[model samples]
Target: MFIKIIKRTMTIILIIIGLLVISYLLFTNFYPNFGGDIANEQKEVYQKSKQYKDGKFHNTKPVPKDLSFPETLKLAYTFFTTNVPNGRPKEDLKTKKVDSINIANYQGEARMFWFGHSSFLLQMDSKTILLDPMLGKVAAPHPLLGANRFNKEFPLAIEKLPAIDAVIFSHDHYDHLDYGTILKIKDKTKHFYVPLGLGTHLKKWGVHPDKITELDWWQNTVLDGLNLICTPAQHFSGRKFNTSQSTLWCSWVIKSKTENIYFSGDSGYATHFKEIGEQYGPFDLALMECGQYNQMWSDIHMMPEETAQAGLDVKAKKIMPIHWAGFKLALHAWTDPINRVQAKAQELNITLITPKLGEEIIVKDTTNNYPKWWEKY
Candidate 1:
């Protein structure tokens, strides 16, 4: 009877393990949010890239990403359990509604509308382009798996957004490349410019292959007099468990007839900033990454001071902080990024623009002093 009881216990354990394995397989395979799998043909193409190695892509300079078992446990524990004061807002952040009619009929100079975080609606030289437009409420594979947006509404609903001339993606991180937002805007989007290997995600999500242009670092494509160049950024990418660094990541340089802009997608403090500035310096405006960072991952994300210095390294005439004011992805205070970066920018004498979410930011208008919007809370 004792022998039989041991056998029953073993059988129950196996059954539970089998169920968990089945659930994981089904979830990963059926879930569209996990993004595309690398095909054999895609692998052959990836292997040709200088950044590609035995099985994955590498940064221009190697970044140490591995944490020890104990470090991993401690990191996870802090991430899951730490109670951060002001990690999120006391109230929903204020916002202004974006009008579609204004977008269609604007005869103004090059302008931008921020949708919070790294998303931007850029209207320049009669073209409408979206930069990392992850305009969803949650920044995770599933809505239930993440926090909701701090502000209840965006400047414009994704469904009501104007027809897009182009979409630019720096990488495939869920916070930057949202599946739901792509599904809604892909039909209206004319072309997509992404780093090498990133088009795989778009194709799987139903974006036409011809509509997607995959570019390597320093490679460029032109659209109606607008030049879009995929530049280098020190970062990594993945949307699912097994796909980390399976795709290339990048920053972008945009040149119109009268305006030059640089968008730093996400990056650590590195020499790539200096290199990019040498190659494409003196940008009229630059959107710099300024949030979701910690020393544990110092090689992948910049601290506030590094952010300010990066703007100078990129030769930006003026800078604006992004990658914040949208999600509470780190333990820092929600306003910490802006507050810290603002101090550094002032010290460095780098003119930084702090625009309210949904406010119109004109490229050449240096006199309009943006209200310190986050201080009210």
Candidate 2:
């Protein structure tokens, strides 16, 4: 009996070692399998851009917030240990027929289609843009990890996608950007707009030098009639270690000839929202981050009330909450964020638009007569 037990222990240890070796090999080999030397150079340039004339790359007074380490760990434990199942209503979760977006209809104007979980297709005049497009089954690289994606099917697959003028990425976090989705739509995309050094990840995935454009905070890029401005957000970035904050993370301001829209990419409560509003707000619509929130990372992700206040700070005419209802990124009930945001918006006299997955919401004239869509979940 002792000999058999010893043999079993050795076998188990050998199996564990083999798995680790295989995991490392796969990650090193194919993880960043797209970009090459040019991509690395771009990353260096992005790093250099962060420094201000005063010599410090980060010059602004750091925004103060509560991000206690112990609180964060407790939040993580609650999310993992708790078996609470959070998701949209089963009936509402089903994908309705969504036709392809028409750029001609939105010519010289701004329009957006939410594809669930921080992904949106924005059209400004003739320019077609996709923001943090994640058309994958899982947010994490390995299917076994990360939460399942909210919308299982996209209105249009990457291969079937229309000619995309540009793809704007918020950060390198898995939920915000998926490698598999990028691989599929890489060829369809004409240009890539990302914060700081994120191009490294894209180039590693196969994007070319001329196609990638990395920007720093407050930097602006002109695409057709639309101006894509990279604004500051309270968040960090990295797909692996030795790379955290190597790339800048930011929200975006999409301004066209007639309208301006703020995409609050992903951020927690910060006075910067008010600053952003004063600088480039009074927007027609604000797509603020409003999901996957907890006390641990409250400094990085805003709670529902904070999200509603962000809209007011930005002086936005209407608010549509994103970053929730698609994945269980936090411990809150699946419908908690939306439900909270909805009540808060009503109390503040702010118009809230609750769209279905793949629903098209016209910012200029959002029709709110639709039934309480989230209640069905």
Candidate 3:
């Protein structure tokens, strides 16, 4: 009887384990948001990249992709149990409405519209380009898994946007490369430029392989005389647990005839910034990452102080902070990133642009005072 009881217990345990394994596999594989697997052909492209090795991409400097499982559990416990002061805005963020007619009729010079977080619509040289356009309401692969964006609306609805000449992606992270946004804009976008292996996700998401152009670090392509260079960034990428760093991650240098702009997709502070600055210095503007960061993950995400230094390292004449005011991905207060970045920028005497969502940020105009908008919320 005791033997039989032990057998039954073992059977129950085995069944639960089997069920969990099945659930995990089903969610990671069947869910479209978990993203695409790297094909052998894409592997060939990745193999040639200096950053790729042992079936994965590695940061130029070694860094933890995420905390250990035990640490993650502990962190999760603290995150929910402890109250973070103003971790999210008490009120919905206010934003400007973008006129699609103005966008379609845009002329004269480059202009940018922030859709909060790292999403931006950049029009330059008679072309419309999207930089990390994660315009979705949530950052997770599924709605139930992530926090809602602080803003109730965007500068312009994604469905109402004008024709897009190109879309540039920094990596395949859910927040930066949203699946839903891709579905909405894929047919409208003429071309997609991404780092190596990221094309696999776009291709799987119904973006024709021809429309996707994947570049290795330091590789560059010109779009109607605009130079788009994929440069090194110290970060990791993985939509699913097992696929971390299977794709490349990097910053970008988008240079037009008269303007050079650097978009730091997601990176920690590193020597790569100096190298990028030396290679492509004197940028007219830089959009730097300055949110969803913590000391425990400092090796992967830059502290607010490091963000200002990175701007200087990239030799940006004017800098704007991004990767905040969209979602609360870290333990810090929602406003902490901008405040800290602002303080550092002031001390360093770096010109900082803090534009409201949907406000027009003219590329060459440095004197326009963007209001301290976040303070209002």
Candidate 4:
């Protein structure tokens, strides 16, 4: 009886091991490669497009050596092995509900609050623009793949979001744009601004064609005294299989009559910042990308110091590092990026604002004064 029991136990253990091996192989092979070929092709076409033709891809800034795949994977594995710390969810914060911004009050002023990660609500003049809103809990299509979103939830649910004059999508990356959020907020949006091919995903997700305005790099669009200029970024994009660079990735310069705001959608160290600054700089504010960076993907995401430098490159008066404290896209400690950014910004003497998820930082006409809001967290 003992021998028989041992045989059965061995059989079950073997089965489990076999299943584990199969699952890893499946994810490593099929899952990662699912849309890979299409993405590769899209990249080829994107490279040949006018944006590339105009020398946008030619200029670049020096990046660190660590942003390679091997290093990125190693760091990611190490990050997963270590436990991540927690912070107060934005929902728990006693934030001021932006029910109705007296456009009259802050007239000629600008205000921006990062909901989390790439989700930023900007109020410039009387227009409210939401940038790459990924307010959902999971940054993945399904909840299992991505880490849980850090904030309690966006201060307001997507359906409950106030009227958005424009929804600017940086790319199709899950962390940048949320499908469900768009579905809910679509009706309230008058225009959906995105890069060349990103509109395809928005359309697939139910946003109307007429509502979508696709722009290549250096393209400019005007709406209600706001000039939206799409500039290039060193990055890639895709939502599913076969569509990698079919769309463009970019930063944006939001210039109203008096205020200049730049959103570094997602980028590596690039010379475009200086060019962008020359074209539309001396900006009052720059919502630069500063999180989810690993040495492996350094070509795409900016490191903490790189982010601050980019702010200076663009000649921004104030820098509010966005892209951190929301999702664990990289293995680093949750607060490490912001901590590093603060240090770097201080060294550079660049003004940095660390607002809570829902806390609004109003750029007043007189000057930009931000309290140390992230101190408690």
Model 3: lDDT of residue 91: 94
lDDT for residue 2 in candidate 3, whole number 0-100: 100
Q: Global lDDT for candidate 4?
A: 0.74
Report the number of clashing residue pairs per model: 0, 11, 0, 9
lDDT by residue (29-122, candidate 3, tens digit) is 9989888999777687678778988899998777865578788789888776777889999999988998889898888699899999999999
Q: Stretches of candidate 3 above 4 Å error?
A: 1-7, 65-68
- Which should have the higher TM-score, number 3 or number 4? 3
Residue-by-residue lDDT tens digits, candidate 2, 1-377: 99999999999999999998888766755755322222444444544564322212232444323346687577567767887655434643655445555443456446677788898888776778899997777766577866676666765556666778999999888788887888888898899999877787887788896999888888998887679899988877655533445566789998887888999988878887998999997899999899888786677899999999999998899999999867777777778898899899989989888877666677687567656666666
Residue ranges of candidate 1 with Cα displaced over 4 Å: 1-15, 67-74
lDDT of 1: 0.90
Best by lDDT: 3
lDDT tens readout by residue for model 4, 1-377: 99999999999999999998887666534642222222444456666566543312222433323245577677658866866555323333344455443422444457876687878878887887888887777877667777677666565556667778899987778888776677788888899888876776677666778998878889999987789999988787665423444456888888888788888888888888898999888988888999888786788889999999999999988888888877777757667788899899999998887777777677543354556555555
Off by over 4 Å in 2: 1-29, 32-44, 50-78, 85-92, 101-109
Which is the leading candidate under TM-score? 3
How far off is model 4, as Cα RMSD?
A: 6.0
lDDT (Cα atoms) of all candidates against the true structure: 0.90, 0.76, 0.91, 0.74
TM-score of each: 0.95, 0.84, 0.96, 0.78
CA RMSD of all predictions = 2.0, 4.6, 1.5, 6.0
